[model samples]
Target: MKRKKFASLMPREALKRSKSAPTIVVIGPSTSGKSTLVYVLVNHRIIGFITVGIGDKSQTTIIPCNFAFDERIEKDEHFAMRIRIKDFSAKDVHIEILEQLAKLFASNELSTEDTLDSIDVEWFQNILEPKDAAYHLGKMEKQISIEDFKESIADVLCAIENAEPSFSERVKVKKKELAQQKVKISEIRRMVFEDIWGSISDDLLARYFKWLDYIGENITNNLNLLLGEDNSLGGIHDYSANEDDIFMYGGTILQTLFDPFEPFSLIVEDITLACRPRTEIITRSDENIPLRFCLRDTMGLTQIGMDSNSIKDALDIALNCSPDSILLLMNLEERDDVIAESCDAIAEKLSKATKLDVPVNVIFTKADRLIGNLVNKSNKETVVLKQDDYDATILGAIDNMEENIRGYLTKLPQKNGMWLSLRYLDEGIDPIQRALKNQGSDKFERFTPTGLYQNIDEIIRETQKRILPEGIETPLFVTAIDADAPAVEMKVEGKMISNIFNSIQNVLTEDNSVVNGYTITTKYTLSGRSVVAYYNKLQRGQGHTTRANVYGNFSINMKAMLNKILCNEIPDFLTLYESQVIGTVVDNLIDIELEHLVQEFDKNQHYKDLAFCDINPALISKWSDKQRNTQILHQAIRQYFSSSEKYYMVMDKVAFNLSYGNEQIRKIIDGVYQKPISYDQTMREMQDTFKKIFATQAFSAIIAKEIGDAMTDLINKMIILV
Candidate 1:
């Protein structure tokens, strides 16, 4: 069977596109698997190293390793080095392996040097065999000073220059030279070790040992700070120990192994002692590890005299690289109040100062204590339900807790965008480690028996989507359901329909067109309203009932379309009048003789009305003029003509009516037009005065009748206009 393997299988086209993949920063607490994530991203392998200090954590492993690939190196140069210094067991093994190599080199050199001395003795015996006739070779070997021995060898080599030395002769000469140089080489090796060990004073070494002991105590005080303490770095076997002595011893052994190569370096400072610095040795190879990571514990904020300036300095160091993501480490088991307060301050400052959209991931370390309590309760339950039953309850409880914390945080005003995670005891692998490995890929798509990688892909994908301009549409449909009802009950369908409509409206209004001049028309229909409820007993049924019916249709045009209504209706009063008149009279009095005259008068008066209506007179003057009699007469006549054709034919109708009316009323009507009733009128003067008064009064009466007729016509015209 073929061995299974995990590798990125991006298409060639996808690979091309990935050339500009955005950078991502993985930030979390010390044991939250930031380094492991970088490992999996580049090497498809898990790096089991645990970083120790805040400053010593890995920045990036992939980019540096990739850079090293350009420099020719053995083994592809892309291998990721685990920079976690606190994983003592693994570090110990690494140190032991290198120490063995160093010992092997020493042992081989010593043995070879001894063998060369014996060979030189044998060569001297061969040269001094008495019958060989060579010049006193044994005496020469003893009597020659070391400097003279080297000179004689050089002279013999010059005398034999034309004569090619045989392979056997060359081997003999090489053995003798190796024998002479053996003691000097041994001294040189010893001197090298001495020089390395002597760099620090005995007092300094003693202090380091004491500091190492203190570190062990600190680890016990905050055990989660140590590798494998919370099971995050891996399980602790017999190797688990909280002793500063052991850590320091381990460090010494590590230094001996790696100091030769200068693979990595870290500066350690004592926060309580004015930040006194010390350098630690790492790596044995001459070439530096592509990535170097470090970790350091700082004094508590109170211990450090938590001034704003000092806190800012620490934050600057923590955020030096402007990490795309920030992990705020909070030890739940420690002074949580202090941690929470510090985090709030840091978050506030970061948000105000930086334009970088740093997503903060908060790790509640020592979560095992909380988890253990939950698990114990779950186990003691009487029912032996399926695994999912237990898991669902636990996850639901956790989710509720998470939501409560989020709600509390959101109220702070400074805690926007902070995400939370519990640092669960690593049963076999770190949850954060699994998250980092599964991100940017589709391997772990669902929640497994263990929710190690829960929602990781969602977070990463969302962040990437925000950064990239790729036009990927994600369709989200929301249907609001009443929680009191069954899951299948849909209280409000298309809950986001209003939002969708608004979005479309916004787009159209902002752009003035959809796809340029192709106006968008939106229509909404009320499908139906439905009622669902559980009933104890019904006429025919015992279970719940669901009822649905059609409601109605409702719509609104785009503002642009509404503008068309205004443009067509409000400008010219004459056009509006003619439209109303044609609509009414066209059906009522199409053949009337006055119809042509009405149409002709409207055509001639159109331009004048347009011009006069355009002038917006002062309201006071307009109102005052309306109260005068002549103005009123003119208005009444205009209204009459505007209302109906019968106003224009009023003389014809009035003459016919008057002739047919009762004689007495007809006489009164005709007398009013002929003369005014004047009590004191002289024969000639009275007739003139009566005629003048009659004409004025008659005109007023005629106008008043016309006004009444026009009002009747206007009422009828309005019905048609509406």
Candidate 2:
């Protein structure tokens, strides 16, 4: 994409030549130097003032005042000119003069002072000589034709009424024409000088020039209307007075005193009595007279009656004025609730009404009051208070009066509104001054090194690690104890838990790759089975056939794999089981509480990294009498399953249901010599039982499928080894 070029700033030459002027609206708390500043800027002239009234009554400044320096000039004895300065800046003065000079002059070469000085006796008398003046005035009156001057003068006299017209009458007519000529000359001269010299001027000239410029520009643009306030000081009790007296005594006797010729900058000590709106009194009767007053008119600076409410009206006016920035001056010394409330209300309304996203700075006018209260004061260094501190004190006060003034705005169900900041201007550094300096800086960038968004990111990362499950592949099951007895109580035997955890880990990590110096496919699932002997028989009976089939198919395959491992076909299990025994001894070093034992086991690296191992029941019988040894092994397995808390934990973690209809199958197997049960019937019954178990517990079906796949893989490896 092509980069766009930046627009050039307005040239000084163009600004000088431009006829328009900018308007500045100054507002602040009652005595915060608004009017004083305006006086100084206007060449120390107090052109306007605002009266706030005395005591409990509220008073306002009304009417817009225009101040400018007028220079009068004379051209010849008959003509005089008035040149009014229109605008002023640091560079030069802009002025308006008469228009007649355009007829005789092609170039503007005459200065105002030069033009005024040139009006000496010769030029005056020469232009006003009897014959010449008569001829000129006649031409002006269209009384005599240039071709027949003599005859036309006689005819012009005949048209005059019954009279003896004097020579001075003609000269009087000539004077007016001369005055018109002087005005024209002045206008042309001003235009010419401005064209050449631009508006550059010395300090004194610059001040007056700017003053005049503001007046003319404000008047033409209706800015005065925007700044004007209502001045009728009508008492609320006016109707009680008699009709005749009402007209005389209804309004307050106020006067709007202003010095229009004064300069822009003048220090004003007290505005309360110095400035007042003008008023008149009327009499209705001897005892019922009342004061009458006129509503101050807007000085064509702005239009009146733009809105229904005063606040909205003022806001509309402010927005149109397009203030560079707003300074909300609050007087902290008075601690006046009403004054603060009014300021807040105005600020809120202005923010809502304005088009420009103008920054508003709330300046606390009397910060010296809080100087003594500051703790942790930095004498030589600038103190920086946290946002919370400002919100607690300054904002808290505003919120107290206007309950909805603070952060309550965010709770409202609305979108796309202005954002505001609550601040205390402070004694040392003025917030408004800082705001003016950084008016257009990035709002989101933090002034301090740290911010809130940085803290939120850290919290979210910690939460993610705690909740997501972790493993390397599919068909993975996490072993956890699932015990139920309304809550079972058991002494935590550290050695037993650690042995179980390490045993599982050893099985899972065991290498099954070497057999006859050949690499074999050796992979196993690290799984845990419940050792609790007390089973839910009712649940088992409901799905007897289905459970039997599952045991015969899946569980039997897993059992076969264990048989191979136990028989030393896969020597890794021998080492794994041996390690489990040794690890159990090492576990006795730790202390454990029963409630905490479950979580500790889950957190253990041994349990998390454990691998599966297969075991054989037949090996036990072979070591002794087949029947007696088999019974002993069965009883031992039952006791282990029944007594170990880890048994139920593994069932829950793996989501396994071990109840199967093996009792009937056992009976048949025991009576194998007496009555032979068909293989078809037995296998069919097992399949039915497995299907019923899966149908009864859908979640168990998910675990069963995963276990089945793992078992199948293990069996295939064992078969290959055999």
The candidate that wins on lDDT is 1
Q: Taking the tens digit of each residue's C-alpha lDDT, what string does model 2 give over 369-479? A: 332133223232336654333323443233342342233233222212222222234423643223323444332212111211121112212222211223211111111
* 1-722 per-residue lDDT for model 1 (tens digits): 33222122112211221212222333333343333333222211111221121122322111111101111111111121122222111111112222332233344442423322333444334433223121122333433233332232232222222224532343345445456445344333332322222233444334333333332333333323322342232121111112232121122221221221111211111111000001111111112211111121221111121333444434443343222334344433334454456555665656522433445444344344443344445654455434343343445444544564564365344353332333333423443224334343232221221232333333433433333212322211111122111111101112223332233334333544432222212121111111001100110011122231211122222122322322232222243233332111122222332233233224444423542453456642565321222222223334434443332222222222222122333344334322211111111232233223323424334322432332333222111010
Write down the TM-score of every candidate.
0.26, 0.18
Candidate 1 global TM-score? 0.26
C-alpha lDDT of all candidate models, in order = 0.28, 0.25
For model 2 the local lDDT of residue 190 reads 30
RMSD of each: 44.0, 44.6
Poorest lDDT segment (10 consecutive residues) of candidate 2: 525-534
